[model samples]
Each structure stands twice: as C-alpha cells, then as structure tokens.
Target: MRRSIGETVILRYWNEGFEVQLKCQVEYIDNRTQMVIVSKQAEVLNIEFRNIYETL
Candidate 1:
C-alpha cells in the first residue's frame, strides 16, 4: 500500500528493545530516499516508509 503526505498513519518502531506505536500525520515524503516525515503532537520524526505499520 502506498501512502501520501497529509495522511494519518500509525507508526510502529522499536525503542529501547520495546515496540512503540505512535499516531502521527504524514508531513513530508522523500521518494528518492524512501523516507517519510511525520508529526505527532509537537514532535516530528523522520522514518522509513516501510516502518509505517498502518494507515488511519
């Protein structure tokens, strides 16, 4: 499944050996790098597109 900027998604990733999930909105996408920028609350994160577990 392809995701686009401005879409709401669930980002799942590993942190401190534990799985963490965050609800964020896609802020930007770098197709060349296959990286995505998402924002949750006041935080912004740079993540791989594949790390986006689900769309909401």
Candidate 2:
C-alpha cells in the first residue's frame, strides 16, 4: 500500500538482538530511486527495496 505523510505504518525488523516498532510519516516515495523516505518529527529516514518490478 502507498502510504502518505502523517500516516502511521507498521515496521517489523529484528536485528542485533533488538526489535523496533517505529511509527513514522511517509515523506516521499521515489520511483526513480526505488526508495521510501520517512520522517519521525525531525528525523529523516530512508528505506530501500529490491523488487523484480515496481507498480505505477
């Protein structure tokens, strides 16, 4: 699903013996870069995905 700014997303990742539950805002979704940029108030976050193909 394509989320928008101020939307809360569910993030699940277990790494380094730690689990994080992050509620962030979707700042931008870049099709050219295949990346999802999020923001937590003042912090900017970047997420990357490797898919066979992307949808429009």
Candidate 3:
C-alpha cells in the first residue's frame, strides 16, 4: 500500500540481533528513490519502501 506523509505506520527492523517494531509517523517520502523518512521518539529514520512490513 502507498503511504503518505503524516500517516501513522508500524516500522520493523533488526536491532541488536533482534527484530524490533516501532510505531512511527511518516515525515517524508521520496518516490523516485522509494525511500521514506519517519520519526519515532524524536529520532528520524530513513527507510526503504520495501522494508515497510505494513501500514496502519
């Protein structure tokens, strides 16, 4: 699914050899690069669109 800015989503990634899931807000998206920027706990993350497991 296509996500837009300001949308709330769940982001999952590997951290410390463990899969971590975080609920974050979409801050920006680069369609050409297929990259998304999300903010969680004051941290901004640059993640690939494919890395997004799901949108909520």
Best by TM-score: 3
- lDDT per model vs. reference: 0.74, 0.60, 0.75
lDDT of 2: 0.60
Judged by lDDT against the true structure, how good is candidate 1? 0.74
Candidate 2: tens digits of C-alpha lDDT, residues 1-56: 36554576654444345655566776777889977777888999776644212222
**Candidate 2 root-mean-square deviation in Å:** 5.8
Clashing residue pairs, candidate 2?
none
Using TM-score as the yardstick, the better of models 1 and 2 is 1
lDDT of 2 at 42: 92
Can you tell me which runs of candidate 2 are displaced by over 4 Å?
13-20, 51-56
Better of 2 and 3 by TM-score: 3
TM values, all candidates: 0.63, 0.59, 0.66
Segments of candidate 1 deviating more than 4 angstroms: 1-4, 15-17
Which one is best on lDDT?
3
Candidate 3 has a TM-score of: 0.66
Greater lDDT among 1 and 3 belongs to 3
Q: Write the per-residue lDDT of candidate 3 for residues 1-56, one digit (tens) a residue.
A: 35457888777765446666888888988889988888988899887776666565
Write out the backbone clash pairs for model 1.
none
